[model samples]
Target: MAKSMSLLWGAGSPPCRRVMIVLEEKKLQGCKHKLLSFEKGEHKSQEVLDINPRGQFRRGVPSFKHGDLVVNESYAACFYLESQFKSQGNKLVPDSPAEQALMYQRMFEGLTLYEKLKAVIGYTWFVPEEERHDSALKRNKEALATELRLWEVLLVTFFPTVATLFRFGLSAERYPQLGGYNALLKDRPSIKASWPPHWLENLKGQDNLKDI
Candidate 1:
């Protein structure tokens, strides 16, 4: 079954890397996969669109396929893999009900985190320079600061690898704990094995949230 699975993903995309990390953690490295290029718009190619019709309109890497089943959403792909291959690798879903509930809550909250972070910095990447405004950027930074306050507890969570992408903009002086946690996550075997090829080639990344 692992041999029959195939994943289409972009190396630099955090969501795509999240799926890769899950696959590694689940001992599904035998699954065939291809790395698409966002710079070249390979994610919108006909091959991807065939499995993920929404790819035509949305940015859609991290698409997973198992036999006849296709999973388009990154979070769904990770959960499906965890559920289907529960006994194959390291346990992900907690055995206790309370722990499971907390894990699920954190898992879903990841979407809100991504949304808030994107609002603060996505414009510089996706929006045209002419369309970007200082006023909107200010509002986004304020909203993100508020969101960060709510997540001030210890950093153990479902998507640590995905969250590490934000480290580029996060100041170590301002977020010392998160900086240490980010370093630890990057050293994890799954994260290191699935590290983006492009990122390795270019060690530096854009600092879009230096002000935040």
Candidate 2:
């Protein structure tokens, strides 16, 4: 653990949760840590401002105000933690040459996942009820549907062993695979420890209906 490292984060945001998850997964031999509260307005404080030049971020990833490295994006934080704690989970990240290529591909998909989810959250919950845009909602939902199909097709085409289990294209399809994947993701102790439990409401679980 670095002597001067600190993680500024919120309790329920997925982005912050991801950071915490990565750290816990790495579990470097000795890491002293602190969790700053976003609800307390710590993120907007001068301390954070000094470290994050942009002074702004998406999701719950906090800006680092005074560190050798500052990160405001959750995915970047994941990449950073993986690099810093390579020893603990020497093989946590994909290592084989083919896996390496797949890793980048997954990261790219993960980035897209983050962006699309953010849009869903912003449209469904963040925007004030009165200011909410139907067009935006429609667009996001449509996009989500499209993305769902893409994921389903890939699952069926490339991972057929797990294909029967996931219903990706529609809520009415059999999605045991996707559900299994989500269950696996949630099973990770690191993700379980850091993931925002309170925000589960935001998930609405509507996507699960695809298998209906």
lDDT of 2 by residue, 102-152 (tens): 777865775565455456545655677888887887777667556655665
Each candidate's TM vs. the true structure?
Answer: 0.91, 0.70
Question: Each candidate: what lDDT?
Answer: 0.77, 0.54
Error of 2 at 166 (Å): 15
What TM-score quantifies how close candidate 1 is to the native fold?
0.91
lDDT of 1: 0.77
Error of 1 at 20 (Å): 0.7
lDDT of 2 at 125: 53
